[model samples]
Structure formats: C-alpha cells, structure tokens
Target chain A: MIGTAQKIAIEKTKTSKITSVDFDNLPFGSVFSDHMLVCDYRNGAWEAPKIMPYQPISLDPSAKIFHYGQSVFEGMKAYRDKDHNIWLFRPEDNYKRLNVSSKRMAMPELPKEYFMEGLKTLLQLDRDWIPQSEGSSLYVRPFIFASGRGFHASPADEYKFIIATAPSGAYFSSGKVKVLIEETYSRAANGGVGFAKAGGNYAGQFYPTQLAVEKGYQQVIWTDDNAHEYIEEAGAMNIFVRIKDTLVTGPVSDRILDGITRKSILEIAREEGIPAEVRKLKVNEVVEAAKNGTLKEMFGAGTAAVVSPIAAFGYRGSDYDLPQLEKSYASRFKKRITDIQYNRSEDSFGWRFKV
Target chain B: MIGTAQKIAIEKTKTSKITSVDFDNLPFGSVFSDHMLVCDYRNGAWEAPKIMPYQPISLDPSAKIFHYGQSVFEGMKAYRDKDHNIWLFRPEDNYKRLNVSSKRMAMPELPKEYFMEGLKTLLQLDRDWIPQSEGSSLYVRPFIFASGRGFHASPADEYKFIIATAPSGAYFSSGKVKVLIEETYSRAANGGVGFAKAGGNYAGQFYPTQLAVEKGYQQVIWTDDNAHEYIEEAGAMNIFVRIKDTLVTGPVSDRILDGITRKSILEIAREEGIPAEVRKLKVNEVVEAAKNGTLKEMFGAGTAAVVSPIAAFGYRGSDYDLPQLEKSYASRFKKRITDIQYNRSEDSFGWRFKV
Candidate 1:
C-alpha cells in the first residue's frame, strides 16, 4: 500500500538452514521469487504496507498462522501479452474470494481497494519475472495470515497480508491426467469453509491424495460431506460432468467452492448453445452411467488449469477410462478460457482486467 | 536430540523486534518462549532436527500453505508440578492425531519420536518461560505446513514441523461461562475435517463465533452440518448434556473432534455409574428437557477449559437458563481431570506421561 505502484527494497540474509535450492528451469512451485508484498494490520487499520525483497519473517515461533493454521490465500496469474501488457483474468473475483476466505478463517478481511492496488504494485515491479513462454505466467499468490504472536485458540488481533509471485508453467507436464473418486476422504465439510477458499481445506486433501498418488492417480475427486455418495469437486478445482450433450456440475453450497473459472466456463457453455446444469452429480448414477458409456467426458475447472481433462477415475478398486471426443469441451473450454485470459481473443465476458 | 539430559545451550537468538515485555502478566497466546523446536523433511525423511531460538521463517509469498490452506496443528500443554517436574498428558494421542490431520492435509507424517524428542528439547531449554500460576501451564502448539514455496493444486514436496510454547493463566477469571446454540451456521460437516485438528477447521468458526461474541456469548454450540438441527461440539471443544439421570452427547465421526477431555469424562461417568449415551443430541430435546425440568446441567469439555458449565444457552433466538446444582459435574469432573494433571490425585486412567 505504501507504493502507488508496487515498489520493493531488496534485503539479503543468509540462512544455512537447508541446502541451496536450484533456481534454473524450475518446475511449478519448485523455484522462488526474490521479493514479496507485505502489509500489517494493527490498531484496527492497515499500516506500513510495503514490498521487500523476499526474506524470512521473524515470528515468535508461536505465531497463530503456524499453529492454529489460521491462514487463507488466492491463486491468479499475471500474463505477459505479446505487446508486454500485464493482464489479470477476473482479478476482482480473486480479491472478493480472498475476503470471503478471510472472514471464514477469522482473519482480517482485506479491503478490495488495497488488494487490487497491492496486486498492481507487485505486478508492475515484478514484470521481469513473468515468463513469456506459452502456458507460462507469473503465478500471483496473495495471502493473509493470523500473525498474532501466541499459542491460543482465538481470533488474531493483528495480521499481515503478503503477496508473492512465482513463474509457473503448465499445471501438468503430461497431456492428460488420471484421478480418483474420493470415497473415503473429503476436502471440506458441509457448513464448513468449503465455500471459502481457505488453506486448511487443501491441506486436508494431501494425505488422501498421497494415497491416490500411490494408486497411480493425479488427483482425488471429493464427494459430498454427508454420505460421500454425491460427487463434489476435484482437489482445489470445481468439477464438471459431461453426459452426452449436457454439462453438469455441483451447485455452490456449504460444500463446493464458487470457483472463478467455474463460473466463467458456465457462461461460455451458454454462449456456445450448450446446456449447463449446476446441481448434484451422484456417484452411483455416474458410476452406473460410466459402465453403460453415457459418461462421455470428465474434467476439472479452476484458475490454475482452466480445464484439465480426466483420463480416468479410480473407484472401489476398479478403474474406468473415459470416452474420447474429437471436439471435446475440455480442450474447447480450455482454449476459450485461456484465449480470453491471454488476450488472444476478444474479452466478450469482460473477465480480463489490466494490471 | 543431540543433547544430554543435563541443561545446555541449545540455540540462542533474542528477538529484537519485541523490545520490552512483562512475561508474568501475559495474556493467553500473547507471549512466546525464546527457543522453538524445528524439523524439516527432505529426501523422503525428516532431517535437520534442532531446537533454536525463535526467529523469522522466510518463505516465498506463493507458498502453498497460503493459497490452498495446506496446514494443520495440534494443541497440548506441558504442566509443571510442585516438584518442578514437567509432564505431557496424552501427547502421543496428540502427535498421532497431528499426523492423521497432516496426512489428511497432504503433509508429511512427523515421526512420533521427533514429536516427543522435539518437545523435550524445547521445553528443557525454555523451562524458565513456563509460568507457575494455578491454572497456568506451557501451552505447546505443534503444526506441519506445505513448505513447497509456490502455487499449484498439488501437495508440497517439502515440509517444516515446529513446536512453540506460551505461558498462560486461566481462560476465564470466573470459573463459569455461558454458550449459545448456533442453529444456522454449523462448525463442520459429516465427512469434513471436524474430526481432525486442522487449522482450517478453527478458521471456519470465526465468523459465526464472532457473531456470538458480539451478542455477549462466549462460544457457539455448533450443530450437525446437513440440517443444523442436532447439537455437536463447540468450535474448539466438545459439548456434554445432562438430562435427568441420563447423559447424552453427540457421537464422534468424521464431522466432530474426538476430544481428549470428552472421552475422559465419559470414562469418569461410567466409573461413577452414571448413564452416559454418546448419540445425536437434538436442540429441541434439550429445550424440551429443560422445559420438563429434566435438563439437570450442560457444559463443554476440552483441554482449554477442562469443564466449562453453561449458565445459559441462546437457541432459536430464545435464551434458556438452567438451575444450578450443588454437585455440578463440571466442578467434580474438572477437579477429577485437573487433579491427575497436576499430580495431586491418582492416575487411575494412566493418562499422564512423565518427561
């Protein structure tokens, strides 16, 4: 907030804690950014907002975010168009969802102006960091944490909102992905923070996902909280079911997330004369249909992948491969979403915002 | 782990960020000990185990814990007895549960030995920081986070486990407290992280809990996720209902925390020949029982409060107060639990572990 456009002062502190990480040709999330945006909340207002060269933040070791896990975040990208203009796809959605996530986590709700302005500041200063390769973008991570120094079970009075960017390539280096229908583990619960993009929800998926990974799958498709009989979502992304000509997804509730990409895809489906259903997709029905070949395609929708086609879904010790389509919605939707995101197409939906 | 039983210099770094402070009159979670236990996971094993003076942990702003909520935590206390002895009650249970939570969040499993060994190292060095107040103890918080420093919808390849302690006094200066029944917002869903001690679980309750605080209530009694019709646990504690000669409470599942104190109380109730039933507790039943004079008493049980008697419950926009009894279970059971905790009574259940 101190910088009208993001400005940062570099600081270097050597830490011999871990081995030196390789910084060249990094995979997604395997590299680093040298600077980050930070702002503090104290005396009931945000103060001393600034970006500093990425360095370790000294904490009491009893900070609530570490122990209580009182943290939430947003995932977006800063795209470098051919003309070198930085573009954010539906950034207002991320800013709005971040506040919703903060309220659910009992952390401070960031001002919309502050969040938007903060992104503008960080993106402008870190323009060199945004990679230019196809499927490449500067992954923008804006997060808020309960930084109150303590080991107690309560809302944090003081907080720090920080923004960091990482240059991430495609979500999957592979062309297709295989996932598991999560019959046992769940990402979130009904009446919980499922609707809010809170960090704990993703952490909950790690263990079950590791199991899925061992079983040779890429992701777990979570079911409903009550019975696990209803299909819900795939990890942090919202899911879509393609049955013949109709596209279906779970309704937003206390269980599923209201993803920014999910919403945009629905609008695109409407624009293309495709019928989209936002309702519960029961597991039994889908499984039975998969056996009979009505399940034409399955894919996940989120800001990260845009659209990731499911190669297969493992369920009840059985594996099933989805039917292939020549003009598949997965590829179509992905291209449509990305075209608007990267400014390769007209912004008919007005989703893209200039940074 | 490298240290002998004799006191030695582990690691030293006084925080200059905090200039001055009174450690004695500290608010719960408002202060921290100097040294903290830290362990890292690298190359498929936990390595670099050390107890160092508390300091800032540098992270890429795009760390996965911030965006996707990949974090979980555990809360337990190290108590000091009259002999200046330190003890951990059900620490193994906490460590095991922490792994259960970590696995659910896609984090690495922290070794039980590391958990025990880490606490021993940190507490031994920071023993002077543990207060000696009547209801005071060194509150220990152990947590694991996704240390993979960037954003994508996948598990972290690296992790950091830490333990920090805080000196605290009584939660409520007055022994008694009041609670409200939240008939709208639920704490967790049937197949959610309610059972796990995940950080996101605590964050989800902040909004509704804040509403309760604004209305002059201490906490919200969360109901079942689906209907919000049946009573469940407190946001951070478990609820116990005493109606007539029968004691009824919600059954444990994926949706509710298997509270340590709640189980201990059930064991005590069984020992005392009291009829204790762990089943779905409906709000209407409690209201009707209170109307029929069958509702003897109600209270919450957890490590934080031990046993907190509910003076009144606001449900369905109506408040109900119960008549106080001479032999409230809160007093007797709290005494029974704390007596064993402070080494003043028999450890019949073998719950306490001496360090």
Candidate 2:
C-alpha cells in the first residue's frame, strides 16, 4: 500500500469495442480489454497512476527503448471463476519480478502500490472482458520501458509503466509439440541478465527458434552459453523432465528464469508425494535416457501454456519420441493448478487474489 | 540509383527551430534536425518514402519492438565541406548492413533505394543543421522496427523505417580511456546475432558495462562467450593492438560486429604499408606482451569515436598501464581518416559521396 493515498485518474472510452470481438475465437494478445493502467516516472518520483481507454501511445522517434532495448515486462493472467468472480494468480510475484527485471536493465523500480492498485482497478473496470470458458483467461501484461528521447546508450531519465489486458484462449492449440536441442546458439551466459524478463532475452531467441521451427520443431531447448552440455531452459518457458519415477529440472541460476508456473508445478508435485529434483540436467544424459527408454516425459512450464507436453525432441540430426503416460505428473499438476485457478477446489495455498 | 525515378514526398516545417539549438554545447543525441525520412512496410512490400517533420510517433502498447526487441539500427555521419556542400561517407555499406540485421532479427528488409534516396532528401532539407566545426558532424541514425501490436513471440507484419539526424560533438570527450577485460559476462555467442546491429545486443551489455564504469573503467573489452580466452570487441567498438610495428586485431566472426570504422582503419593501415594481421588474440598473449613490453599501443575503433586510444586495462583485479608513445599508430590513423572526412585530403578510395 505504498501509494494508497494517491488518487488514480480514470477516463472511460466513449464506446466499447468488446461487442465486436468474438470471445469464442479470441487470440492470445491481439484483442485488448477496454481500459489500461499507466504511470510515468520523472524528476525522481512516479506520477499518480491512471486508468484510461486502451489506445496507442505517442513516443519520440529517439526514445531509448527503441534504440537500446531498455525495457522489461511481466506476463500473468486473471481467471474467471465459476462464481463469476475475477481472480489473479500470484500477482504479487509478478510485481516483484518486474522490479527484478527493471533493476537488471538499469531502469527504475516502480512502486508496489502503483503496480498492484492500478492493476486491480483496471481489472475491475474490465471485468466483463474476462473469459469464463475453461482454460481461457484474461492475459495481463505489465511492462515498463525507457521513454525519453535521449540516445546516450545509458539508462533513460524518464520511464513509463503500463498494464494492459487481453482476453486470451489457450496459448497453444496443439496438445503436444516437438523441440530442438540447440547447441550452436546459446540463450544466456553467466553474469548476464538472462534471469530478467528483459525484451532482448526474448528477441535473441527468435532467430534460433525460427531455425528450429524450420526443422520441424516448435521450440528450442537452450543450453549454457559457455558449454552446450548442460540444459538451460526452453524458449520463453522452463523445462521439466520425468525419468522413470523422478521429476528433474534445471535449478534456477543467474542464467535461468525463475518462472512462476515452474515453481507452482514443483510445489504441487511435492505436495502430491511425487519426488522432484532441481539440478543441472546434462544434454548427454537426456539423450542417453531417451535412447534407452528411461526418459518418460518432457514438458514446458510458463504462464501462457501452463503445461506443454513435448511429443519428441531432436538432437544431433535424430529425433527421439517421448513416451506418453496415462496418469502423469504434468497432467496432475496442471489439473491441480487449474482447479484452484477456476475456484473448483479449496484454496490451500492461498495463491489466488480477488480483484 | 535503385529508386532514382521514384519521387520522395517532402513536407517542410512551418517554422525552423534552428535558433533555439546550442550547437556549441550540443549533447550527443539530444538535438535533432528539422526533417526525417519515413517509410512503411506491409503486405510483402515497402511503401514510397516520405520526408516529414521530426515528431513523435504513435504506437500500440503491445508493439513487437516494445515487448520482443524486434528492431535494428545503423549509425553513420554526414559531413559539411568547406564549400558548404554536404557529403556522406560509405552510406551504401550501412544500407546493406541494415538489411543484414533485418534478416537476422526476422524483420522486413528495407530497400536500398528507399534508404538512400530518403536520406539524401532529408539531409538536403535539413542542411543547416550540419555542424562544420572540427570533431563535429551530423549523426545519422537509420533504423527499422516492428510496428504491429502482436505478442506471439514472433515477427510483426507491419514495419517502420526511419532516418533522423542529430548534431553531435565527439562521443567520448576524453582522448584516452581505460577499459576492463570482461570475463564473467558475454556480448554475443556462436550462431547468435552479434554481427547484426540489433538493439538487444547493445541492451545486454549495459549492466556489465556499468559495473566496469563503477570500477573506474570507461569501456569493456568483451571476449568469446564459449572460452573467454579469445578477444572479441570493445563495448561498441572493435579493438586493435599495435605490437612492435605489427598491427593485430580479432577477425570478424558471428560474435563480433563488422564495424565500419574497423574496416576503414584496416584498409588505411595496409595502404600505408603498415602490416596488419587479423586473428584470434588470446588473453594470455596480451598479458605476456604487456609484461614483456612488446605491446606498443592499444586503441578502440568505431564510427562514433573514430579512434579512442586506450590508457590502461584491468584484468584479474590488476591494472596495466600502456606506455604512451611519442607518435602512436592510433593518432596517425585518426589524422588520416579525419582529414579525408573533413575534406582536407584526397579521397583515394572513393568513400565520400556528395549530397
């Protein structure tokens, strides 16, 4: 409650575009909610947050964000429970992570009250845009970028923090996807800002991911920049491997993103009496396990997809198909999280927050 | 020549702001010329170029460039001759490199005719902004970025290409600077977009470079991401070392930017009968040379500074001072290039083009 005393300015749109949008055929981030939250930083302090109609922003051509990529963002979702109440899943975690990313990018940290209160207000105003369909929710995007017109290759003096919402269906239409183990390109290195949700971290992976896509894979399993032996993470997601009876994933480091979905799944797996391990998973070990039929399943964890099962993986010019299970850890964790998210089960963890 | 027949639409400003600009105390990129070149891309082709008044551009909050860093840019300069005629040095190279960067970032490639003709027309319209003082020129920045509001972690369908000019003095006011050898962080990796002038590449270095600056260093000498044994480039420039009359530099690779200034210096060094070698220079070899007094001089080569001599360098928590020479190769090369750039010497290589 940092800026609780500061009143937020509100401006409603003259007309609503919600009727034109087909909720049944909603895209992930194409259609936006009616309102957006915005706050500006200048002169050593943040301005009062405002909620206005979702619209385009006017920026100078020389804004540092466009030239230096000095921007950070967070991705979360608001689920519409069966009772018609809107809920945010661990939004405080997203607020904290956005500051972590902003610090790494040399941008200023936003106030907790500004971020939290603004988002709650925005979501309340656009409650009707929240999708009640199963596995669909209103995707929340909170981003901050350098907005001043200076080109000094340093942190900008001015910044803009914004929260925009979009009604999104399932991230991936396919139930399963194939991935490529990347060796030539590295996603991040030691002491780099890889752990931060910076825009460049995502941009740097597009070319390599495209190459993998051209080779019949939907995503790339990145490796350490120093050595290609150890598995890092998947494109925009954390990876998990199930070998026989144990679930293994790469431990979060300075070079690995600490995904919220990944953490939630690991917690649910442990609660369900499933053994889980967090250690460096070598590529060679995974390849060997795939060849010997010990690697039972692989999946990607992120906010968008929740849980994306990997059908096959390609390594060294060969593809290895993963075996499917009738009752697997991924499905179990996915169901548990979604059950809590949709308010179908008791809230044991106190993870959901009402807007 | 490609678009010589196509007319570029020009719009003049109602009133000039030239009188308000302080050319004598100009910051690097804070001030801009009156006019700018702009073009759009959609449906598989580029629109006709237009030169309009420099102003703010309206963009959607979810534009790909703001979230995914899908952008590329080029830096060059326009010089004013003594006869008041404007000239551009090797703009076609920048035009071609812009496309190279665009391809790597998955953005649409800009046409050569659009780039060249638009720049020529804009410069012609804003000719009064070019500074004629020594060590000062109009900095030309040509850039292309994703303009559509899509958050699919993919390339955008709409694109904007723009060229803007700013009157700038020297990038680094100090003639000599100290650099730190970075071993913990990496700038680029194998099969990465390091060679491309992508915005993410620059953003990734700010944190590490800030650490170096706090340690009393002006820049950082980056190393290979894989081994950290071979030298790559400086923060934004290419590193060149003179060892007992033989010049040595790291060869261009996927992890190093093909700097325009680096190439020009290499050509000038060879043409002047100074033997130059391009190979991987090991850190151990540089330390050994420094200890044995074989390293005569070290300098950074780039378009901004032209040639910035290195005063010292720190490695492994120890600083090594480079002995100042009476007549260093850095000074000699700097004089030759500046003389040609200022139109005081003959253009033997046809690098200069009149506007």
- Candidate 2 Cα lDDT to native: 0.87
What digit string (tens of lDDT, one per residue) describes model 1 on residues A1-355? Answer: 4444433343432442113433335466545565677888987888756767766565545566766678877888888889999999999989888887777777777777678877887777667677777787777878788777665577777888888777777777786789999877666666677777777777777678888889999888998766888888886688898987899998887767889889998999999999899888899878887999989889999877768899888899999999878999888999998888788999888998998
Candidate with top DockQ is 2
Q: Alpha-carbon error at B31 in model 1, in Å?
A: 2.6
Q: Which segments of candidate 1 are over 4 A away from where they belong?
A: A1-26, B1-9, B12-26
Going through the candidates in order, what is the number of backbone clashes in each? 15, 0
How good is the docking of model 1, by CAPRI class? medium
Candidate chain B TM-scores, in order: 0.93, 0.98
Instruction: Show model 2 residue runs off by greater than 4 Å.
Output: none
First chain TM-score for all predictions: 0.93, 0.98
Residue B109, candidate 2: C-alpha displacement in angstroms: 1.3
* Candidate 2 RMSD computed on C-alpha atoms after optimal superposition onto the true structure: 1.7
Candidates, DockQ: 0.60, 0.65
